[model samples]
Target: MTRASRFRSLALAAVCLVLFSVLGYAVTGDRAPLDSFDVEGRNLEDWADDSRAFIDVLRVVEHLFATVGMTVLTVVLVLGLLLRRQRWAALLALVVMVATSLSTSALKVWLGRDRPEWQGTDFSPLSSYSFPSGHASSTAAYACLLVTLLVLFVRRASLRRLGIVLVVAWWLLVCLDRVLLGRHYPTDVIAGSLLGIGIFALGLALVDPRPRSTAAHAEPLPEVYASERRVAVILNPIKVEDVGQFRSVVSAMARESGWSEPTWQYTTVEDPGTGMAEKAAVSGADLVIVCGGDGTVREVCAELAGTGIPVGIIPAGTGNLLARNLDVPLYLRSAIDVALNGQDRAIDLVRVGGDGIEDTHFMVMAGMGFDAAIMEGVNEDIKKKIGWVAYVVSGLRSLMFPAIKVEIQVDDGEPTTHRARTVVVGNVGFLQAGMPLLPDATLDDGILDVVIIHPRQFLSWITVAMRVLRKSPIVDETLDRRTGSRVRIKASTDTPRQLDGDSVGEGRELWMECIHGRLLVRVPR
Candidate 1:
């Protein structure tokens, strides 16, 4: 943590402590000043007691955030963190929650305040002290912890805002439930919230939950060269939130991995990555890290093909098909670690050409008709705001795209004619979320897998989706699959086309040939 951050955390904790101390002092002893406020706060409970329905709802809310409920939530949160390999975050969450709960119990016992006589008889009476509300404290701590994690791990600003809003709303409901159900006084909830917030702030100051630098845990690799290894990074500046911070992180990781300082190059509107990648290779870089979407990855990979320099991919795109297919981690730091320390695997690249577009290469898949229409119709502004959700919006709008007649020829076979809503040729089997659109496709198999979908009606798309998801081998007019080292698709008329999720305008034909073991990339060891 920076000095400013540490100072801010300490200041917040100190403020909470002072407020809690004053509140505690005022609420204790007979004839306390807060007694009147606490008594008046029961008016909400009096109103709630008139309606059994409202009382019952509050009771459910009470039980949902009670000690047992909170325990289950905490355990799930910690386990999820551990499963994601965020061990430090998991430990921090466990320690802060346990410590907060135990501290609340101790403070409640010390204060020894009695529950209000106005407490509802509809539910079992609490035998515990009432000065510090357990529900308020636990919920506060959970909300704080979750917000911290969201800020640390979630890259989308809109998503982080939504998560924070939901967490805050939940916390408010719990606090309101405490008062409405006559479980604790307003002052009691306030003190509990302050205590929880204070403890969490203290924990934040003491434990940085981010994963340690890759250098801290990785074993040194065997010396394979006598000279210092050179590394380079080609970044699309718009993809990351802070370019300077990203540069710092990559530079630090490169240093710790024993590589020389990376030669940095940012992609431009004129040249997304090809020029930068060629420059990096010409500079004698041993490793080149590319951080961008599938289109950018494709450009860099095409340039670096057969160069013997391993490419590290950091997936920072709406559709990171290449990285996902390669089993690369989406988490930025983890992807960096894999890039610095993982093994290299040779993968296939597809060379594609069409009528209206220049001959280019794609690392993942190429599509025509409906799929390309979806890509072409996507609203760039909306995509920038919500990431991949824009694709869903576009897909829904283009679901009933008219089918087009096409001829497909695999290898040296005679051309076969069919009507297809979409024709997709994949270098990798799965699309996003592991959807097996082409189940038999393998990255380095020296062949391309093709899927032709001709859902006649709007409802027929369901069957198409089911068949793809189930990896069904039954191929007919509704859905068909073919494979060959060289595949050519020719539409009867002009149709939309896409390469690696990028719209490449309307074209009547696309010819693709897979180059086996064409490029080297880093993957988890």
Candidate 2:
């Protein structure tokens, strides 16, 4: 979700709530027709009203699913989502519940509409402003949010439709109970229900406005020559100490699988893996396996883009962003098995270019400013010792980096100017520590997701962190996002930059283009 769309959704919901609250106050006053209709409906249902058993059941139901009860239920559900790493859905659910409850309270006090007078229906009395029914709004919000989640996740069409119907029916029953028990007028419940629906729609726009990918299955792989195909491995020697042992396992596995002897290219500190990958590809390798960190993979991928040979990954780095996106196993043996037997899937690769550097390709992400600082400042020895924890230390030291003014242009659109602490463009969703900076990003989507941060003060990092954790689309001056196939950025000063975690020095400008499905990757069948 972009910043503009998020702002517009919230504004529209606020307008709808205000309009409904005003309409309820203007029409549902003393001696109003809605009050007469409520009394007449009670009169028509005299037998059901006099049934002590039905009344007791409804009273118990209302007490159990009331505002307090629903709050508890929402907390439990949100906590579960967080624990499961479903942060976006949890934030949406939490926002809807809190906004619905708070709005109901504020509107009730503002309108000050009174409850229906129960003469002889055995309806218990309660004293409170009742312009909009709190029970009706709370239940309606839960129902609407549930329907949204069901539509997004439930695959069976019949099940989705049935779940929505059941939820709506339950909400209507709650509203009816509110009116029948003389706790609220019909118009009050109607307005409250509308408010709930409005909030729900807003939440959807904030968190899930983009249409989900609808492919039922991954693309089928082409035929592989099991008998004659040649396998080539680009191995980073420093990444593994037992090089002879690793080669023995590879050779044994290759022999057992009916493939020829594996061709090997050892990577050097000066030439990570790109030159070796080129050599292997030119030597007629059928499949090229990369065994190292993100930088090595990026180098190999850049060298082999559009060559039609599938690249397999053995994740031996701190942040295996591309491997995680491809669902490749992290263990060495499992990764080798996947590389040999897995299916090939086409994925997008990003081409980046800027001042003072040759064009390069990155399969994961590119960033400027604060993100680059975090990468550049990492202690190499610490990274080798403790893996990804080195990044945390660097990130903490770089939080107070100064924001810079930049002009950003998306595709053919006019350039938009802003001050930002960092700018990131990604082809995949998750980050090193599993934070989904771009929740809706897909590997083969043929576009890039851009996020910009501009927190005004160090204290505001808390707010920014919360928004990221929630995956909230709402943005003020502190955060914004955009998506496009081509992005051009020019900063006021030469800022630090990085591509797929490799430092690229400071540059004043960057131009990136998404190369759609330009590379093939091996993924588990």
Candidate 3:
């Protein structure tokens, strides 16, 4: 952690400590000034008792955030972190919560504060001390941990803001529930919240939860050449939350991997990646790292196809299809490490051309009809806020898109006519969440896999989904599969089209040919 962040955390912990001490002293002494706050809390409880329904809701909230409930939530969160390979973060969460809860129990016993006279009898009788509310402290600690994780991991500003808002709302609801249900005084919750937050801040000051730098443990590989290795970065500026931080990370990792300082190129609105890639190649970069969506990756790969310069991909898009297929890590630092040190593999690229669009290449998939419509119909604003979930919303709306007649010709075979809702041609098999839409597809294979879906009724989609998920070999009119090196799809009318999850406008025809081992890309060894 940086010095400034450490100092800020120390300052916050100190402030919370001072406030908590003062409140504890005032509450334990005779006729203390803070006692009036508890009196006001009792008055609020009297008003709340008038509404049986509201009290009933608070009772449910109380049970949900009680000791047993919070323990379950904490265990789930820590296990999830461990499953995601966040060892340091999981350790930090476990340590901070356990330490805070134990400290709170000890303090309550030491203070020996009694429950309020107005404590409700509608629920179980209180045998525990009430000066420091356990519900308030546990919720505060969990909230702090969640906010820290969001800051460290979540990249999208809108999504981070939403997560923080929800966390804060949850904490506030727990605090309010304790006071309104006559379980604890307002001052008791205040002290409990401070105790929890203070311990968390102190813990953060001592522990950095980010994964350790790979350079610390990585072994040197045999030198490929005796000359200085040159690296170049082609970045899509808007794809990252902070450009400077991304640059710093890439530069640091490259240096550790024995590469010279990298030359940088930023993608522009007019030219997403083609021009930048050409510049990197002309400058004689040994390895060019491209950080953007699949479209940018496609452009760079196409430009550097036969030049023998391997491309490294740092996927920063909603659907990182190529990275997923290549088994590249999605965690930013892990992806960077793989880019700098992993082996290079030659992969096939699909050349595509259709009416109303220029000739182009796709490294992942191309689609026509309902799937394309979902991509086109996505709300840009909502997408900015929630990432890929916006696609789910759009997909639901376009699930019943009317089927259209299309002609499919694979390789030199005779054209076959069929009615379909969507036709997807994939250079790689899986979609997001490991959905095996094209189970037979392989990246280096000189063939394209096609799937034709014609779910006539709404319920038929369920069957199609089950078959896709199971990778069932059975093919029928509902879901037919095809494969060829060269495929031509001609729609009866103009239909929506997308390339690698990007909408490429409406067209009546899409022609694609798979080129064998056309490009070299970095992949895990």
Q: Model 3, range 1-525, lDDT digits (tens) per residue? A: 889999999999999989998888888847478776688888878888889899999999999988899899999999999987788889989988898889889989988788777867676758789878889999999999999999877778898899999999999999998888888989999999999999999999998887765433566556677656899999999889889999999998788778999999999989999998999989889999999988888888888888888999999988889999998867788788888888789999899999989898999999999999999999988888899899999999999999999999999999999999999999999999889999899999899999999999999999999999999999889999999999999999999999988899998999999999989998876
TM-score of each: 0.87, 0.58, 0.91
Ranking by TM-score: 3, 1, 2
Per-residue accuracy of model 1 over 249-299 as CA lDDT, tens digit each: 889988887789999999999999999999999988899999999988999
Q: Which lDDT tens digits does candidate 2 get at residues 162-201?
A: 7889989988898877766667666777788888877876
On the 0 to 100 scale, the lDDT of residue 458 in model 3 is 100
lDDT of all the models against the reference? Answer: 0.90, 0.81, 0.90
Among all windows of 10 consecutive residues in model 1, the one with the lowest summed lDDT is 213-222
- The reply for model 3, stretches above 4 Å from the true place, is 2-11, 14-22, 29-33, 214-216, 412-415
Task: Kindly report the root-mean-square deviation of model 3 from the true structure over all alpha carbons.
Answer: 2.6
lDDT of 1: 0.90
Models sorted by lDDT, best on top: 1, 3, 2
Whichever of 1 and 2 has more TM-score, that candidate is: 1
